[model samples]
Target chain A: MKKFISVLMSALIVGTSVFMLSGCGNGEKQQELNVFNWGEYISNGEDGTIDTIREFENRYNVKVNYTNYESNEEMYNLIKESNSSYDVIVPSDYMISKLIKEDMLEKINFDNVPNFANIMEKYKKTDFDPTGEYSVPYDWGVVALVYNKTMVKEKPKSFSVLWDKQYSGNILMFNNSRDAMAIAMRLKGINPTEITKKDIDVASAYLKEQKPLLKKYVMDQVFTEMEGDQAAMAPYYAGDVAVMMSNNENLDYMLPEEGSNWFMDSMCIPKTTQNKELAEKFINFMLEPEIGKANIEYLGYSTPNQKVYDLLDEDVKNNELNYPKEEYLKKCYTFSDLPQDVYDYMQEEFLKVQA
Target chain B: MKSKAPSIPYLIWMLLFTIIPLIMVIYYAFTDKSGNFTIQTFKDSLFYTDVFIRSLWIALVSTLLCLVLAYPLSYVMSRSSRRGQNILTMLIMLPMWMNFILRIYAWVLLLQNDGLIDLAVKFLGLDVPLLGNAGAVILGMVYNYLPFMILPIHAVMLKIDNSLIEASKDLGANKFNVFRKVVFPLSIPGIISGTTMVFVPTASTFLVAQYLGGTGDKMIGDVIENIFQRDKNVGSAISLVLMVIILLFIIVMNKFGDEEVVA
Candidate 1:
């Protein structure tokens, strides 16, 4: 029996390796375009529905290789390693800035992307890539409080509510350094874009005090925690807030009066990519009003394209989560690139708080 | 002398798959971003005390749970009829035949707040979150590695002499006493092998902790993976520290295990 089990284990390792290696070599050679983006953030032909990549593949005879990363950092590392030549990448505002500064992105030929006109005026230029050089806006959303109306007596109006001891073990916060720091910065009346090392240290201590009260630190799936009543309130992307509220009647979203991180995910070509034209074509196809609208509607995120935004359903257009009022926008700020020293300090503080 | 060394193919395979990769990891652990050799990377990773402690705790708990659950199951299989033994063994090995990733996905489907378990609870009119806790992490680790525990213990049990057990019974020793005095002590080798097998992989596995476990439940595997994938060579250094700790654990376990036998 002992010899048999050892033999079986050895056989499994060998057999699995052989099978994996066999699959490796047969990858078809074609005019291929690779894309890296967030999971569940794009339509993938579920239930026979037409998806974005499927449309691109059918129209341009180019094989599309779509992969996902849980966070922007994960995507950055893959592009940084292996020279895999990802033709298109969707990264948030600050990351787009970092990539450009590192010279890892290709300059966009706006002439090739005629559909750039569809983009809303507000999302056209930003502190990151301010010249509109490398990236095209994909979607925009805010990080806001997703709360259970039934669990809490009063509505959460500020980031301070998440820190309140009354809701001990009932709050969830973002796990990312930027999102976590943004909330603490907003609460203290500090602009997230210009956060200093001292500010991060203060935020770190503030978060550490709040940690015992927090049910957990969450990322993209903050809604799951809120909907299940595991946490009474969590910081979540605005689009997800709408989905959680709709799916669970007990839940609701509030754009904190003190504001939160507002972000735009944009598509950019990596410098290592060989097929630049195919990359530009894919970007343009995504920008088509109908294509853009379908993605926005399917994914529940706000569209950067004005045509797509106009074509959205009445509920989506009116959904406060998708389109907050101007007063709310006044308090919000886009994340900007922090200096290396400040970033290092934030990373250190984040580690301490997590511990 | 009919002695001949193992074939070149076998040695080459081991070198390429295991030895070379291990060396690469160690090499990366020392190198900085500019590809220059540096000890600063090692110095940087020493600060991640949380990741190391959390991973160790999770692996320790999971190993304990596997041991507790596996002992009885292996005992039953060993003592059962041949036909029953074969059938039970097959069933135990069947879940592992599927892809590890697929098994994780199945667990996700079953454990999601809106998933099968939740639906069943709702049908029975109860509300509870069983999917995201220390309990769930244990369940996943056990579910993935129970076969490892069972097979080793069953091997040891199969090799156990029946006469010794019969004599213990004839000496007025109850079943519980017989198990405690004879069966449990004799199965130490199996326990060590199974524990090591279950503990090491469970410690290094990131997917289970990242997906099934909750926020505070984050393990060292997740941290190492986050660092490695994010191009933080410092994370590789942290991993090297973890590897050293695991090596020390094995050495300690072996020393104590031998000491116990001698005593």
Candidate 2:
């Protein structure tokens, strides 16, 4: 029995060493780049379309490691906690600002990315990266009120429709703190980016009042609930609402008269990146007209690439929901990183509302 | 004698994964973001007493429900033929083969307002709010944890000597007395293990409440998760408090089990 046990232990050690050695065997000569973006935010050559990553790999002779994240906060936390070196990450405006403030991001060398000029003038040098030094705009969209036309008697024009007692138990609110508080702040005509403690208290009180009327606070589940007609109304990104509207004709989106959030998700290289030049090459590849057009078509989001916008079909270009009038743009607010104290206060207040 | 050699790997694993991570949590719980020692996070966790109380109440209710459902089911399974027992156990484990998140999502589809349950109720000329409430959350918990309660008790029940039960009957004890005096006392260990297994996870779960419960049913797990994304220090502090509470509950339960066994 002791001899058998020794044989078993030797076998286990040999097996584990073999497994470990196999992982290190992939010492390929090709340079590797890691790209992390949002889930379902890219076009991957489904249905005979352009396979963007494969095209990049074949063109540049470099191996690409791609991953996806569900939320910016989740991506931020993972990058902060793990030593894993991600070359390129896509984060929204506020998160990009937070990363920049923490000095966690690397400045882009625009000379390496000559295609940076393909981005439109409007999307350049925004508040998140004031000098446009760290990030390249990937996609931009607005937050709007999505509602069922069949259920409601009139067109809802204001954010107050969410707080209407008649729609109690039929409304869905964003599950995240910043987006939920933004809506409440917008309803109270308070600037979401310039948040103060007093603003947080007032907005949180408003959210508490709105709590009983909510059916559920959700994030990605909004698509299933809204498309199934289980929910009558919710505040969500315009791009997602567009996807839902295509599946369910009864659904429509409205940009509330009280203004809304206009968010820009951008790609930035982290300071921990081991291959900065290759990361720049991948970013430039993403900005190519055909690649950008395919991504926007697949994701149903607005694009900042002028060449990609020109390549869009007339019907897509004319979709008012995708491209709202300039008058509406005046009221839209882009979020900036808040003071740490105010951010903490907002999170505490948001939790109090739920509790 | 070959002693203490086989357990070396297990001890190393425990030190690396479990002990080190726990120590890190304790360290973060006591310190600020700047690495200075402070008790502010622990003090901050005091304000979230409502969430803790709610989590405890929900977990207790779910554990009780699992016990109530599992006891009779396990008894029947143990009494069945061996072939039948195998089939029953397999059927109980079939749902676990699927991903846990997907299983919970299936419940979401069945329990929504216009979902399968609501549609069936409407056919009977009734309306029921089956989803987005405290009851839905408890039902989710019970549905997911019933197997944990059943497996341990069933294993224990299968080991009971049939002659002991016969002796109880021969002594003029009714079925109720047999169960109370013999079967119940014998099953205490199984019940204790099953309770611990079900109660601990339920108390710390955020997913079931998020998907099934309405706006008012946030748990301590959800608060910890939410805080973790914003501030890891406060999140670790809350987790430390939760760990202590669960550990205390387990110790108290073990003491009760020991006293009952001794009696």
Candidate 3:
């Protein structure tokens, strides 16, 4: 009798939930596309800027459902869950490779994306998506040293300066595991993209040595510390450092001589996309030089669009902080997905170093 | 006399949100990503024991600081005139009216080098690095949780009868003995509650150390956050252990208090 009662109750609950959930959408059905990109990555009509999403909605007679993610792991986990369908996502190169390896990304239908021609030849082919089949290059940048010019007194041209005790208690390091470990690996003469557990151990040991010299491990706080002149030096993205430099005249950037992490975030349609054609069309729309120019201008990242670069103001084009020369690019290595064991070992060792 | 139907909606809500999530956590704690039963996650969690101990130690220090600071202030507030008490409480809650992160940011500005507190200390010939250490993290925690300690103790202190202190006085007890024998004994429940209010949240807190402390001050909560992105089974295992230890701490605390004093 008890079992029967419980089963009946559960059945009733399941039925009610199904009915209520089915009643959620009652409005007239309109075509929709869900685009998942990083927060503050697009210009949304604020401060006399073009509203990219609104323009796309107007161009296509379809409502666009745009969302934002903070990290590649977060985007990957969400898309892999299959609970929510996204027509498009902007993920970095390593994550793109991970998605490709797992067969989670759909091969792009370049026929629909005519704007693929606008991408520079340099941006089109190397790395995570060699054939450029699974992803479209959106924006790209490299990591570099941002130091207080007044405090450092010398132009920093290497990652080893972060360990220099002269700047101890005034230096900042990346709080995140990946970026921080990548720095350690580069300093230890190990390639970040091709890492082993032994390599992680070597990097972790180096980080442990540098921990005493660091003022703090920071993310957004890097902006406050550098711009306010509270810290002497730190490692951060070049694009952000450019913004920081614009805010504070005493700040400058050093693209390290040895090499640094070159990162690029690109747009890809997931295998679970409900609107494939719409996603491709949206990708092509973003590639339009005017829209790309507006986005990169507002977002403060390096652009992959060739036409956008030509249309850019002279000073902006000449600014090496945002646009590193090909020689600098030659000395840069892009991160790729690590094996699961190596990745887990790196995470655990990084945590251990902090402890 | 009461209908059980009044609670049915709440019961369903709890079943869906609380109970189901608890079950999922337990299941994840004991299982691998593929749902295979494994103790390896717990073994992996053992690597973070030092961080767990450090978070607990910091929480303990902050809880004690809050108690020492809040108890006397709460006592004064409880003894004040009604309007004065209201004003005092408004002052306490005024900072809370603004966003929580902004208040922490204000503390960062005050404590950072060449900022308010640092300059003030430097003028006095004290040259301590104000931020980027364990002490700074403790200071942030103590500042953030002081109100939690104050409010509950203040509420209970208000209920203490004035006549009890007066009667002790009339019985030839001095102010010190009166407080020691009568007033202090009565506030045990308040102290227990206030400690609970301050201690638990501070132990699990994340952002304070990230903002104020150096690289070495990474807490267990931060480890869980980092690992959760790639490995949830280990994250859940660590969380489970923290939950169990916290549960044990509460049980031990309740055991120390009189039965009627604990809720």
Backbone clash numbers for all candidates listed = 1, 0, 0
lDDT of 3 by residue, B1-263 (tens): 88899899999999999999989889999999899999999998898898999999999999999999999999999999999999999999888788878878888899888899999999999999888889998998998999999999899899999999989899999989988888777887788889988889988877788887877788888888877777889989999999998888888877878764443
- Quality of candidate 1's docking, in CAPRI categories? incorrect
Query: Candidate 2 lDDT, tens digit per residue, A1-355?
Result: 9999999999999999998787678664689999999998888999777888899999988888999999887899889989989999999999999999999999999999998889999887999999899999999889988898887778899889999999999999988788899999988889887778998898899999999999999898999989998888999998999999999999988889978898989989999899999999988988999999998888888999998999999998887678878888788898888887887888888887897
Candidate 2 scores a C-alpha RMSD against the true structure in Å of 7.0
Q: Please say which candidate is ahead in DockQ: 1 or 2.
A: 2
Tell me which residue pairs clash in candidate 1.
A169-A213
* Full candidate order by lDDT, most accurate first: 2, 3, 1
Model 2 TM-score relative to the real fold? 0.90
All models, RMSD in angstroms: 10.1, 7.0, 5.9
Summarize candidate 1's per-residue lDDT along B42-83 as a digit string, tens digits. 877776676678778888888888899999999888989999
Error of 3 at A68 (Å): 0.6
Tens digits of per-residue lDDT for model 3 on A202-267?
A: 999999899999888888889999999999999998889988998999999998998899999999
Listed for every candidate in order, the interface RMSD values in angstroms are 3.2, 1.1, 1.5
- Fnat of the models, one by one? 0.19, 0.81, 0.85
TM-score between candidate 3 and the true structure: 0.90
